[model samples]
Structures are given as C-alpha cells and as structure tokens.
Target: MIEFLNPAELPRARAAGALVAGILRTLRGRCAVGTNLRDVDRWAQAMITEAGAQSCYVDYEPSFGRGPFGHYICTSVNDAVLHGRPYDYTLADGDLLTLDLAVAKGGVVADSAVSFIVGGSNPPESVAMISATERALSAGIAAAGPGARIGDISHAIGSVLRDAGYPINTEFGGHGVGSTMHQDPHVPNTGRPGRGYTLRPGLLLALEPWVMADTATLVTDADGWTLRSATGCRTAHSEHTIAITDGGAEILTLPPA
Candidate 1:
C-alpha cells in the first residue's frame, strides 16, 4: 500500500525520523571491537522505550523472512548486508557494520540505515564500499522531488554504484514508507529514467542503495534473516527517509546538527 502524510502530519513524520536517527547515532558511537551484537540490540530496545517509540522491526513478519523479527535493530557486519538479524557475534576491528533502524512515534514511521567501520582498522576496500553507498544515496535523494519519477531516483543511484565498479541488486531495494515500515511503489536501485510512479508532495520514500564488493547475488544465512554476499565479499548500505515536497524532497532522517 502506498501511504502519504498530509502537511499537518509531516511533523510526526519528522519526529519519527529524528528518533531513528538519534538511536543510530548513539549505537554507532557505542559500537567498537569486542562489542556483542546482542548488546547492540539491547541498547536499541532501551533507547526506543525511553523515547516512547515503537520498533517497526520487532514484530515484522514479512514473507521473505523466517518469522517475526525479534530484534530491535539490524546489525550487519562485513559480508552481511540486508535483514541482518542480531546474533552472538563480537565485532572485530575493521569490521564493516551496518545499522538499519525504523521506528514509529506519534503514529508515523521513518526508516534509515548507515554502514561504517567498527574500530581503528579501516580497510580501504570497506571504506570505499561504504562511501559508494553513501554517495549513491545522496544521488538518489537529489533526484527525488515533485514531478520526478521513481525511475529517476533509481537511475541516479544505479549510475553511482555502477561507476564505482559494483554490481546492482534489485532483489531488495528502497520502498514507500509512512504509517508502516514498508509500503508500495517499490524503488529499485537501478532503472530507466522517466518511468515508474511520479513523485508527489507528501509522499514518503526510504531511499537505500546497497552493494556487495564483488557480486550482485545474495545468500541467506542459516538464521534465515541475514543476507550476505554470495562471494563472501564485504558489503555496504546507506539509506534515508525523505518526504516529497512542493519544491523538493526533505530528508527527515538526518541526525541532529
């Protein structure tokens, strides 16, 4: 289902976005070598409760997943990319970590993700992969606005990842997000411009651009939730929830300035 927030409801969307962003920022600061993935999930739960926000993932039971996601946050490390279920693993130096979070506050929801290196060890390949996703995200956001086609955003994102020498995967990509965590108007990472749904004011979209180091293929972990690169190569993902507006799109998931 495609959902749109009226002007009066935009503030609530902003609130949800801010809460998600703040939680991610806090988690990123606390993450380091030897930190357990379960600990990350616990931290997210506490912060969400303290902020009076509901986790959009805790009860998420989409068909693609094994069952209800019983975690507060997605902790993807190194090869793991999307739907990374928190498990018993301690982070290591130079491990690329991706935190994807979504929460609801005041009846509105926002989703966002960020990938970064865990500790003092910053591998060049991992750093470059993360940078590519971030740049692709920015390009996708820049292409979104009133009158813009969803394909425009996809094309903009795909161009960057392709130029970075990374293969694009359309199996899972960005999507409409509003009252719920996921919605209609599926936004692929790559597509032709001037196609797909036309942008309109009040529409909320979660634009994410993710890529594996070598392959576009993904393999599901034994846990049935974590998605990893088929080649075991490192991966990176970046995302933001933006609200389409009269002149342009407003990014609601940016951290506090």
Candidate 2:
C-alpha cells in the first residue's frame, strides 16, 4: 500500500525517523572489535523500548524470510548485505558492517540504514564500496521533489553505482514507507527516467541504494534471512526516509549530534 502523510502526520513521521537514526548512530558508536552481534541487537531493543517505540522487524515474518525475525536490528558484516539476522559473531577490525533499522512511533514508521567499517581498520576496497553507496543515496535524494518521477530518483542512484563499477540488484530496493515498514512503489536502484509514479506532496519514500562489489546476484544464508553477495565480495548499503514537500524532499532520518 502507498501511504501519503498529511501535513499533520509529517511530524510524527519525522519523529520516528529521528528515533531510527539515533538508534543506528548509537549502535554504530558501540560497535567495535570484540563486540558481539547479539549485543548490538540488545542495545537496539533497549533504546526502542525506552523511547516507547515499536520494532518493525522483531516480529516480522515475510514470505522471503524465516518467521519472526526475532531481532531488534539487522547487523550485516562484510559479505552480508540485506536482511542480515543478528548472530553470535563478534566484530573484527576493518569489518564492514551495515546497520538497518526501522521503528514506529506515534503511529508512524521510519526506516534507514548505514554502512561503516568497524574499529580503525580501513580497507580501501571496503571504504570505496561504502562511499559509493552513500554517494548514490545522495544522488537519489537530490532527484526527489514535487513533479519528479520515481524513475528519476532510481536513475540518479543507478548512474552513481554504475559509474563506480558496481553491479545493481533490483530484487530488493526502496519503497513507500509510512505507518508501516514497507509499502508500494518499489524504487529500484536503477531505472529509466520519466517513468513510474510521479512525486507529490505528503508522499514518503525510502530511497535506498545498495550494491555488490563484483556481481548483482545474491545468496540467502542458512539463517533464511541474511542476504549475501553471491560471489562473497564485500557490499554496502545506504538508505533514508524522506517526505516530499512543495519545496523538495525533506530528509527525516538524520543522526543526532
């Protein structure tokens, strides 16, 4: 379902978005070499509960995933990319970790993801991949505004990734989000401009740009939720929830200082 938040509802959406962003920031700060994945999940759970927010993933059971994800946050390290279920693995220096989070507050839901390297180890390839996704995400957001089409956003995002020499995957991408975690208007990472749904005020969209280093193919881990690169190459993902307004797109998810 596609949801458009009226002016009055936008504030609630922003609040949820802020909470999601803050949780991710907190988690990222706490993550380091020797930190357990379960520890990250627990931190997320604590913050969400303290904020009186609901997790969109904890009890999530979709056809593509195992029932009841049973995790507060998605902790994907190195090869793992999307839907990464928290496990017993401890983070290592230079490990590329992606934290994806979603939360519902005041009846509105917001989703966002961030990819960063754990500890002080900076692998050039890993850093490049993560930077590429963030740049692609920024490009997509720049193209979002009233009268714009979803394809425009997708094209902008795809161009960035392609130019960076990364393969694109369309099976899972951004979508309309508000009140619920995922909604209609699937925003592929790549698409032709001047196509798809036209942007309008009050429309909320989650613009995510993710890519694999070598191939576009993905393999599901034994856990049935974590999606990893088919070639086992490092990956990166960046996302944010934005609200379309008369002026342009307003980014709702930003980490607090």
How many angstroms is residue 147 displaced in model 2 relative to the true structure, after the best TM-score fit? 0.9
Can you write out model 2's per-residue Cα lDDT over 1-257, one digit (the tens) per residue? 88888898888988999999998988888998999999999999999999999999999998999788999899999899999999999999999999999999999889999999999989999999999999999999999999999999999999999999999999999999878888988999999999999999999999999999999999999999999999999999999999999999999998886
Please provide TM-scores, in order, for all candidate models, with all chains considered together: 0.99, 0.99
Model 1 Cα lDDT, one tens digit per residue, 1-257: 89888899999999999999999999999998999999999999999999998999999999999999999999998999999999999999898999999999998889999999988987899989999999999999999999999999999999999999999999999999988888989999999999999999999999999999999999999988999999999999999999999989999999998
On lDDT, the candidate that comes out on top is 1
Residue 90, model 2: Cα distance from true site in angstroms: 0.6
Q: Estimate candidate 1's alpha-carbon lDDT, on a 0 to 1 scale.
A: 0.95
Locate the minimum summed-lDDT window of 10 residues in model 2: 1-10
